[model samples]
Each structure stands twice: as C-alpha cells, then as structure tokens.
Target: MNTAVPLDAQSRRALLQRISDILLRPAPTWLRIDAEGTSAAQLYKNYLIYLAAIPALASFIGMSLVGVGAFGMRLRVPIAAGLVNLLVGYVLTLVMVYVMALIANALAPRFQGRRDMPSALKLVAYGATAGLLAGALGIVPALGMLAAVGGLYSIYLIYLGAPVLMKVPRERAVAYTAVLLLCGAVAGMLVGWLTALATPGAGLGQRGAATLRLPGTDIRIDAHSVGQASRRLQEAQREGDGGAATRAATDAIGAMLGARIDTGQMDQASRQLEQARARGDSEAAAEAAGSMVSAALGGKGLPPLSAQQLRAVTPEQFAGLPRTAIKAETNNVMGMAFTQVDARYSQQRQQVQLRLKDLGAAPALAMGMASWASSTSESEDEREIERSYKKAGVAFREKYRKDGSRSELSILLPTRVVLEASGSLPIDELKQALQPVVQQTTALARPPA
Candidate 1:
C-alpha cells in the first residue's frame, strides 16, 4: 500500500484485483498434496489420540504435585510456591497457545473437509499430551524451556498430525490448529485478567448489586438484617439528628451489633480491622469506621459473641483466629465431614430399601429376584444372608440419622444382630446389637451334597 502507484478509479481497481491474485497464491506446484478421500480414515483415529492425552494431563497434575511434595525439606517452600505459580502459569499458557495458533492459522493454508470425530478426539489427546509435558518440565525453573516449546509445538504437531488423524489435507489441519491455539490463548488471558480485576462482590455481576443494599443510617449491616433495620433506621431519620440518634438507640440496646460497623466490609476485610482501631484515627474514612464504645456494662470491653458470630466476623479475623479457637472450629468442620460420610452410606442402604419397596409393589419380578421367605436350595439360603446384610445396613443407617455426633456407633455394621426368621418383631428392651455377620454366600452356589 505504501509503494502503490497513483492510479485513479479503473486503473486502481485493476491494480487491486491483480494484487489480490498475487497475495492469495497457493503452495509451490511440487509441494501441493491432495487429501484423496481419506477423511473417514482420519476421523477414526481419535481413540489413539485419547489413549495418549487423558493419562498425560492427569499424571502431570497429580505426579508433579506429589513430586514436589516428596522433597520434605523444600516441601514447604516449593509446593506452596509451585501451586500458586502453576495456577498463574496455567492461565498464561492458555494465552500463549492462542497467540501461537492464531498466527499459524492466518498464515497457513486451509483445506475444508468433514469433521472426523475420532480424528478430533485424537488431535485433542495429542495436544493435551503436549501441554502436559510442557507444564511438567516447566516445573523445574531451569527446564521451563520445555513448557514454552511443548506448548507451541503441540499446536504445530496437531496441525501436522491432523491429516493422518482426521484424513484431511495436512495443510488444512496445520492452519486450523494454529489459529485455534492463538484464539484460545487470547481468550484465556482475557478471562484470567478480568477475574483478577473483579472485586469479590462485583464478581457476581448484577446479582451482587441486587443482594446488598446501600443506605445512609449511621449504622450498617448485611442484606440479611436490612429488612429488620429499615423500619428502625427510618424512624431514626425522622428524629433528625441521624448519627447521634442511631448511637443513642444502639447504646440503649447494647446487644445490637449493627450500630457502628458496616457488615459488607466485614466479609471482605474481616475482623482484624474491627479489633485494631480504637477511636483515635484521624482520616475521616478510618474515623467513620470506629465502633461506638458502650457504657451500658461500664467498660467490660465488647459483649461476648456466640459461636454463630461468623456473619459478624471479617475474613481477616476468621483467618487469624486464636489457636485454640481454630482447633475448636476445625473440630466443627470434621464433624460436618463425618455427617456427610454417614449420609453417603445411608444413601447406599436406601437403594436396597427402594429394592424392597419394589418387592411389595411388583411381586412377580421381586419374587424372581428372591422376595420369597421359603428356601429353594442352599443357593436360596444364600439370599437370607444377603437379606440380613441389608437389614443390618438399614438399622445402622437409622442409628446414624438419629445422632451422628455419637462418634461410637458410626460403622455400617453394628456389634449386635436382630436375626428374625418369622416373628412379628422383637420387643425385648435393651437388646445389645451384635457384631458383623460373616456368612459366605459364594460357597452356597456349589452343588448340594
């Protein structure tokens, strides 16, 4: 364009048309290769690609982390630093992929063909393997060259391998892979950058705004308490001296926490700031944030907060909790985990219960699967053992639901059994539960003596 001739209208149009032909020229005559109806053959190769890709990605993440952890002395340093770096690198790698791919695609030749699913899967596998190798090698700061090369190489390799995998022209595969990587990298960077920039509340987009409200009433609280605070705040507003009125009402009700602190900032900054500042800060924002000292209890410090004061605490305070309190909090977490594990076992027993329900609803199939109480053979006797397992399973499940905190009766099989043959039910008081029943059902299937 800079070296263009001064042609007007028709002359310029003719020159532009000639320039287009020259610019859009194809490969050298000798280098041109044809696809030859091998599209179907290439698409079927996806299985091999997947065979290579899946294990590589999984192994890279798992093994690398483990390998880093194996250095017990350096574990504290590298593992901690590596994980944070890996997260950042993983994001940056995506950006790199897009840039490499885009240029390859725009400049490379394209050949149109039907998508071969097998070939596509294979291509992904190859690409994944390339990505994994690059990332794993990059873990050794000095060997990071592998990551850079492997990441870019994966795209080129995908393009090169596309023809064999997808049965398309090699040129087309190269072009597509190159462009795809470039676009993908650009997209990844943008997404990561945007996420980094977003404030925790603002990250949820319009939903965040809709959740919390902004108002001027001297006292502040989260949305959960806003409805309750609104009426009282409105009355305070009518009383004219807003800040002082809010303080007077708040001090009178010494237990009300919303009088001084803003709850929204509480979640973001946490309890550290609340515990730190005490009335002498000069900055207006800092001064405004100070909590009002109540003389109700005559200087016995702040009121004692309950266990459920989580909503009132800030994130920083939560992180920097006193050691003993943290351990107590940890126990609470473990207790929840134990409950979930018990629930999982209960769910498995419920599946058996559903099967029992079907026995009552659809007798024919249930009988076929063995709903009958009568023994057909020693093999049929085996079903009784299976039935007992189910019964015990359900019993333990019920016990779990009642009081999972008991900690002692947490197993699927109890120590006591209530083995029933044909009774209505055992009403004996304080019957001790027996231990696990170990009946061999596999041996019962053998020929009878």
Candidate 2:
C-alpha cells in the first residue's frame, strides 16, 4: 500500500537537502539512498514532482514572459500554448523517469546486478538531481545550453549510482549506463516532439482552451489554471530569493560552461526602447538603445558609430571605376542602431558594389559572420570556383564564375566590420575595388573613446 505525503516546509527543506547532497556528494548520497527503504510513490510525490516542475514552470515563464531572441528578432510563445506545452512536458518527464527506473531494474540481471525496483527508482531519481536543478536556467533562454552541461554531470551521477544501488560490477557499469542513456535520449526526443506538437502553430491552434490527447488519456489546459500558475509564479518571484539564487547559479555555471552571449538582455533593452518611443521620450529611448548596444557588444560597452562616420570611410571610386551610386543609413536592430554604407562603381558593362557594415555593436552577429575564420575550403568546377579562407589576418570568402560575368568577395575585419563587394566583374576586380574601402572601414571600426 502507498501513502500520500504532504509537501510542507519540512518536506521542501528535505528536498533541497537531498538535491544538494546528491549533487555535491554523489558517492555517499547514493549509499544512503540505496540503504533507505523509500517507496517509489513517496519519491515521486515528494521529490520528482517538484523537481520536474522546475524545468516546466521555468520554461513557461521564459518562453511566454521573458521570450526568446536572436539576431534582433524576439519571439514569445502564446501564454495558453506555453501553459499547455508545460503540462504535457511535465507529465511526460514524470512518466519517463518511472519508465527509466523500470528499464534499469530489467537490465540489472543482464549486468550481473540485483533486480530491485525500489533501488532502481532511487538511483534514477537521485541521479537526476543535478539535471533537474539546472533546468532552472531555462528561465533565461540564452542560458539554456548550460543545462546540457548539468545533464552530462547527471550521467556521471548515474555512473556512480549504478554500481551502488544496482549492485552492478564497476567493470560493467559503463556499459549499463551507456544503454540506459541511449534509451533516455530516445524518450527525451519523443517528449520534445510531442510537447512541440501541442503548442500553437505546431499542428495545434491557440484560439481557445488547448487539449492534448495521449495514449489512454486526454489532457486539457484551461485558462484559469494558466492564470493561477502565472500569478503564483509572479508572487514567488516577489517573495522569494529566487533572483539572488539564479544570479549566483548563473555565475557558477558560467564559469564551468564557458562564454556564451545572452541575447535576452538585448531583447529587454529593445522593449524598454519601444516603450520610451511610445511615450516620445527621446532621452530615455537613447539610454535604452545604449544599453542594448552594450548587451549586443558582449558587455564591451562601446558606443556605435554614426552614419556620417561610416559614410566617410566609404571610398568614392574603386580600381579606376567611377562611383555610380552611394547611400549611407543608420539601421536599428534590437534597439541598437548600426551604420551601413553602400556604394556602387561601374565602367561599361562591368559593375562592382561595395558594402561596409559596422558590426562593432553586434558581436554575436559578427561572430556568426566570421564563423569560417578557422575553416578553409576550396572547390572548382567547369563553370565556377568557390573558396573560403583566411588571408593576412582577415577572413575572406570569394566566388567567381569562369565566364567572368559575376563574382563576389566578402571580408570580415577584426574590428567587427563586414566588407563585401559583388557585381558582374572578375573576382580579382571585385577584391581590388574593396581594398581601399576595407582599409578605411578597418580604421573606422575602432571602439569609441
């Protein structure tokens, strides 16, 4: 018989203690959990239920409230849809944990270990503590990748627990863990696919109450529960030390996870800029834009160049070709204003277009543009040749047609500027036309004093 356990203050404290112990001292914690006669129902009711919700609720708040952003575009999942997906994913996670425990018990015999369901459940549940706790990072979408590092750590926990709880020989524990991980990965993919399908625009509509049908069960999400959860989450945020904990965890995880650009800050600054613009507060808007620029620059906190300065660096003529058209403008992206200069030179049927973009304020975009810096490739066919390589400390990509009718050359400067020349001319001619523009833009791309 199973007995229900109420999740009171003591239970919550116990849960936290267990999580910390499992993470910081897995070897001893596994032994303690193995010796305890805890039932699967009690474990699920007191531990897995709350821990799994960390990811589900955090993801809901993140996707629907904080939103997701990249390359100056922000996307927020519909509130009702996000709630629906959260419920579906949460249920799937709980089920998957139990299923994994069952698999662990079944594989115990094959690994020359004891087949104790209770021990298997304890191993799977406690071993997943690190991953479940790390799921809180989903609250900031940009930091979500760091969660995978925690997941990797969970694998290590499982490796440690497999030998303790499952009683598997240390020599065969690696194989046992490998098989379980493969199954877990497949189950995870299925859960993600199903949850995505339940969201709006993913084979489902969000016009009203969302309903999802699973095997032998129908899950319906009403607006009332969604509203209640949102209200409670907001209250918790206002009343709890979640903010401080999140910052501390972020710093600790970042030190282990390495460098990653968080675009959420830029998205928030963009919203502030928009609100300021709505109120016609130019000063506030400028401040918000500056913040956005700083975020985009990976915290370098450099101001963006003005349109006139960018235009001044553009060449009026190139390779004896007269300038035919020139235009300079300031474009706003995610609240950060960037200067771009475009110029065209033409003589007879030959034409070359030069574009100089100041990407100093958008280091993420600049990194993406110059991703081929460490890569080198070349291919030549009967009609065209294409190659990407680094030259003289600059990343360049070039393509030319054998007929000499079209060519393109792109250069990524170290100062975070992108210079490109393309037109109906030879590749050499295009490069020649861009040489002076590249030199000038390189000088102009310096950080503001």
Candidate 3:
C-alpha cells in the first residue's frame, strides 16, 4: 500500500474513522492494523500535522473568545500574543512528535524490539489519537480538564502498543514503556522552558522599547525608567530614608498601575483625565489617585507586599528554594517547591504553626525532638501511600496535638509540597510527620537501578 499519497476526501474520512476505532476498540485490533507500515512523510501529512492543530486552534479560539475562568472571573490573554503562543505550540508539537518517534526507534533494540522507524512513528501518531481528539474540548475553556482523561487513555494506548509495534517481548513491555515515558517527560520540560522565554505576557526580565500609559497622566514610561525607579525605591527603603522611600514608591506605583488595561483603554483614560481636569471633577481625580495608590500597595490582583513588609522581607529566608520540583507536564501533576519557611504562634489556637516546604529531602533532619505522632497501629493512622500510573505520592498527618483536640486545624499549603498537622505540637513535629512521605517521593523520583 502506497502511504505516500496525499489524503483526499475519501482517504481523510477513512483516516478519521480509523482513529475513532483506535480510541474505542481494543489495542490488539489497532496494533494489528498499524503494524502494516505507513510512510513517515505520509503519516505526518495525514495525521500528525492536522491532529496537533486541533488543540492549537482550540486554545487560540478559547483564549480569544471564552477566556480562562478563575474564581468566577474571566481572564483573557492578548489576542496577538495568544495567536503567537498558539502557533509556537503547534510547531512544537509537530517537532516533538518526530523527536519521540526517533527516541522510540532508538530504544527499540534495548527492549529487544525490532528497530523500525515507521513502526515507531505509527506508535506515537496513532497512539496519541485519544489526546489530540479530546484536546478539541479546550475551545470551551471550562471543559479543559476533560483533556486529562484523554491523556490518561493515551498512556494506556502506549502500554498496549509497545509490545505490538515496538515488538518487545510481553514480559519486558512495562519496563520498556517506563523508559519511553521518562524520555517524553524530559522533552516536555525542555519545550515548556523554551515556550516561557518566547511568549511575552508575564515574563519579567526582558527589556522592551514599548511604553505604558500611566493611569491619569499623558506621561509614558519605558522599561528602563521602571527598573531605575524600582531600584531607587529599594535603596531608599534600605537606607531608612522615609521621604525618599515614599517618593520612589509613588513613582513605581504610578508607572506600574493599570497593568491590566490595554493600549486603547489607556488612551481613553488619558482623555478622561484631561476632561476631568477641565470640568474640575475632584471625585474623578480622587478615584484615579486611589487606583494608583492601590496598585502600589499590591492591588494589581496579585499577592500584596506593602512598603513596610517589603523592608522586612529578605531573600535570606527563602534561600535555596526551587520554583517547581516534580511536574508531569502531560499529566498536569506538579509539585511546587517551598520558599521562605516561616512560623507564627497563634494565641487563640494555642499552637505554633511552622510553615515550610520539603526541606532538601530531609524533613526530619533539623526537626527538634518531635516524635512520630501516628503509629501505623493507630486507627487514625490510615496512612496508605497513593500510587498509580499517572501519580505516586503520599500524605502524612501528625498523631498527637498539643491541645489534644482536633477542633481547629492549622492547615499550611505553602506549596503543593506540604505537610498538615493540627495539634499544639511544635512546628518541628509537623515537619517530622511529613518526613516519611517526602523521603518516599525522593526515592520514587530516582531512576530504577
């Protein structure tokens, strides 16, 4: 069969139906059909290119139309930037498909499978049918979570196709699949890193010539001006110069205000400012000033840090903290590292809440005299490690409370990597309780020896 021919109307219909079967039917049937070799070029043309486009186009439309919903509010990406991201994501997917196929072919012999490039390509392309199709739901925004189910099913497809397409022995299929998945995980991380640098919405460290319109003024600020102003503010705060600090902070706040407003709206605001000034509308003037002050005080819809708090907070508290630890990109399973470990004594609760993240794989190392609160024999100990193909993690709880009452639990989820205990027990005790699970996760992250 000549798989090189471009897909026509009938061929396209047949191809779609075939993919439908691969998703719904047992792996044995799809593998048998896929084993009948198809050309890499034709496969890319007929399936990979179009299948990957489904999510890219869907995301573009979704962000442009429905937007991302968070806490009952719709947050939309700029259309131009969204389009750029969509195009970049689509191209990345195409490249990754080829890269994964090459990896599969290279790994085939190690698993005692035949080294067939065409089979490898088919394995990836056809195997991904479930995910690519389900990604179409991204257009709805809210239904984006459904795409994860498709991804899980794709993992099942990979497990099933490995023995048949890779020609690996049945006994070695699981081991072979695991290595293949590890390679994929690494590739995903690299792609995400590159994408972050390319897309320009919230990336902070780049210098650009674009100017931002201030809330109530005709003055436009450039990136260099913003940086200088921020540094001056920091210096003033450090020097304990209250007058200079206030002035510097005001400038930074004014420049940073109206971050969410677009260029057109900013122009409108400028016009409104002039009109209000001409009419002597003190109310409008006062409202604009309040917005500028709020934006300066962490009112930009993000976590706030006041001038006083900024002076007190230092990087020393969060030294050696990682932004992200274990993240399965395709699975959307991410564990963020803890930063700035802290503690506070709650008078009403009569307990010290020691806030922290996993401590360099040694949760119990510095913990002082806090013993394991829960014994495996304890009825409340119900500690069962949750392990699955998609995830492997644990949850730990302290056995004893200082108050001896579970009436109020001080839950600390600084990052997804967290330990919870609701007792008058010292903070170290809570850290100690979480040590086993953190240690287990560290072990799980290691490659099979």
Candidate 4:
C-alpha cells in the first residue's frame, strides 16, 4: 500500500509539473496569415510593404493612448490621417509579402511548416530595423541619402532577420538578405543616376533621390535629385569654384530668403548684386556686373575679373572662417577627416557667407572691422592666478561671467573633431592637444613680452 501510494504521488507531481509547463509556455507571435486561403505568390509586395510600416504602426498605438478627446481636446485630422495611411500601407504590404513567400515555397515544394506565412512576416519585420537605421541617416541633406541609408539598413535587417523570420538557417538568410539589398541598391542607384542624366539641363531642377550606395562601399550617398543637387551645390562650395559656388550659394540662400528668384530673372540678377554689395562683396560684384555690361556695350572681351571685382568674391570665399584659432583648427580637422569632410565644411561656410556671408558689425566677426575688439579686463580670477604664481601662493582662477552674446556661430570650438582627420597621429603635436590643465596653466602665464 505504501509503494502504491508513493507511485501515485510521483505521478501526481509529474502531472502538476506538466500542467505548469503548458501554462507558462510563451505564445508564438507570428500570426498564421493565410487562413483565408489566398495564394502565396500574390502576397509578396504587400507583405514587404506592411513589414516596413509596422514600426510606425507600433508607435501610433502608443500615441493613441494619450486620449486627447477624453481630456476634452479637439480632434486633429492630420494625425488620424497619417495613422490611417500608415495602417493601410501596412495592410497592403502584408498582402504582397504573403504572395512573395508562396512563390518561394512553391519553387522548393519541400517546405513542411504549419504556417510559412508567419515566418516570412517575421523575417520582413526584422529586416525593417536595418531600413530604419538607414532612414535615420536621412538627416544629411545631400541626396535623399539619409532616407536611402535608412532604407538600405532596413534591407540589412531583412538579411539579418531572414533566417530567424523565414525559419531558415542563418547562412541562408544572410545570403538571401545580402543578395536582395545589394541588388536593390544597385538597381536603385542606376535608376537614379539614369534619371538624373536624362533630365533637362543635367537635372538640377527636380529633386534627386536622396540616398545612394557608393561604389564598393556599403555607405549610402544622396538619394533624391533635389537633395543630390543640394549636396552637389554644397560640394561645389567646398571646392571653391567661385562662379559655380556663388550660383549654388545664392540658390540655397534664396530658398531660405523666400525671394524665389532664379538666375534667369532680372530681379534675381539684381538681388544677387545687392547681396554681394551687402557682404562688402558688393563693389566687386558690381564691377563684374559693370564689366559684363561693358562687354555687352563693346568693351574688350571680359578679361578675368579686374582686381577690384575680385574683392566681392572674398566675402563669399571666407564666409565662415572661424573667429578664433581654436575654431579654425577644429574646423580644419573636420575638413580633413572622411574623404569629403572638408567639402562639407566648405559648403557650410559658403552658405553662411552667401547668406550672412559677409561679416556684419556683430562683435563675433568684428575682428577686422574694429581696431581692437579682443582687449580683456582684469577679472578677479586672472588676478588671483597671476598673483599666486608671482608670490608662490596657492591660488585658482575663478570662471568669468557667461557672455550673453556667445552663440554657436560666435564662440570658439571645443578640442575634439567630430570626424578624425585621415592620417592623424595619436601623439601630441599641438599644445592644444595636450592636457587641458597644463594648457590652461601655460595660458594663465602670458608668453614673453
């Protein structure tokens, strides 16, 4: 009787454990997509699209919980419309994706899974992460490059997640994803390049695709034509092609100024002349315009712009040179790194020059305009630091009052460069690169008179 009781007790314990295991088991997330019995190949494109939209879908869900109406706020149609568009996009993509999966399954025919659709959906969803990363890079304005990058990243996600999503082995999924992204990127780039080439006047007007895959590198470049054009304009600035640079700068500035004058417009022509003059480049631009007018009115064919006319371009040329040596150095470093980093800075500087392009009477750019703007007062901290060194007494320099006029544009830069210049040595080369305290101490004691 004891043996029988023990056996029964053991069985009961086993039964209880089994019940617990079943209860605790996690539910699978991939929904069986085709209970409605649609064929697989037809669902490919829609499925792919849905996967891309899911992140936005998840975000919308969270956002909806804020309940503006419950709080007595008026409804905004834009928010709802955007959400609906996203949702509809998601649904459509899912349908196409399922169709894509069926095509693959049919070709193989050895696929024995409870529901292949779930795995395919999951795979696409995973790939979407890579695309999202690429999208984040969309901030860099040159070609829809930022967006292209994000999209490219999504493809990588697809590649990385495919194995898990499709229930395929890692190697196979990676191979598939890699192949798809590579092919897609190439096709996309070729199409964009061809489209740009085909457009009128080398296609500077319509927006270019902002994202592109650089040859041999996974890095994405500008994709959209407009962004591409903007980047090109920006690039021309860095190269310092005076004529092209001015044209690019003016176009960008004009957009900001909302003046809407193209080079062809007489008013645009006049405004350009005015902008040059305003920057102290006015005299030079005027001379150049005068020379052009002279050539039209029968002067010796326009010689390289006279020295007088050249002055106008200088304001545009050195548009954003740093106010201090430190900023200059940092700016220089940003230019040196990345193959085109310098170009980026030049582009920015040109833009600054063209718009705020010339130095105003603002204290930041008041260096040349004023005889002596940098004279410092004998602050308490400066006195303490100086007195301590002279008397051999312990002392520390106190900080000065913050300058309200200081702005990102006006102030000196920090030590580090966002991008390290190519071929820079780690060893200390500059005094600034050395320990800050040491530099600070040295700075406290003035150099030989």
Highest TM-score: which candidate?
2
For candidate 2, write residues 1-449 as lDDT tens digits: 02234678888899889987776445567888888999988888888887788787888888988897433335899888888877876777678778778878887886679999999888888887766777787798755633543454565577679989999987556556655644444444455457666654552222222322111112222333333433443444355545543343233222222213234565466568767877999898888766654552445423677778878877767777788888888776445556777787889977777777776655544554454554576778788988878988899988899998999888988776788887798888778767777777777645455
Ten residues in sequence with the least summed lDDT for candidate 4: 331-340
For each candidate, give its TM-score against the true structure.
Answer: 0.24, 0.48, 0.45, 0.26
Clash numbers, per candidate: 23, 0, 2, 58
Question: Deviation in angstroms for 221 in model 2?
Answer: 30
Which parts of model 4 are misplaced by more than 4 Å?
Answer: 1-126, 129-156, 164-167, 197-449
Model 3 per-residue lDDT tens digits across residues 206-314: 2232222110011122344455656766676577755665455444533333122122232243345445656899677555433332222223222212222212221
Error of 3 at 316 (Å): 42
- lDDT, candidate 1, 43-105, per-residue tens: 223222222222233323543553422113122234444344334444333333333333333
CA lDDT for candidate 4 = 0.30
lDDT of each: 0.27, 0.65, 0.48, 0.30
Worst 10 residues of 1 by lDDT: 334-343
By TM-score rank, best first, the candidates go: 2, 3, 4, 1
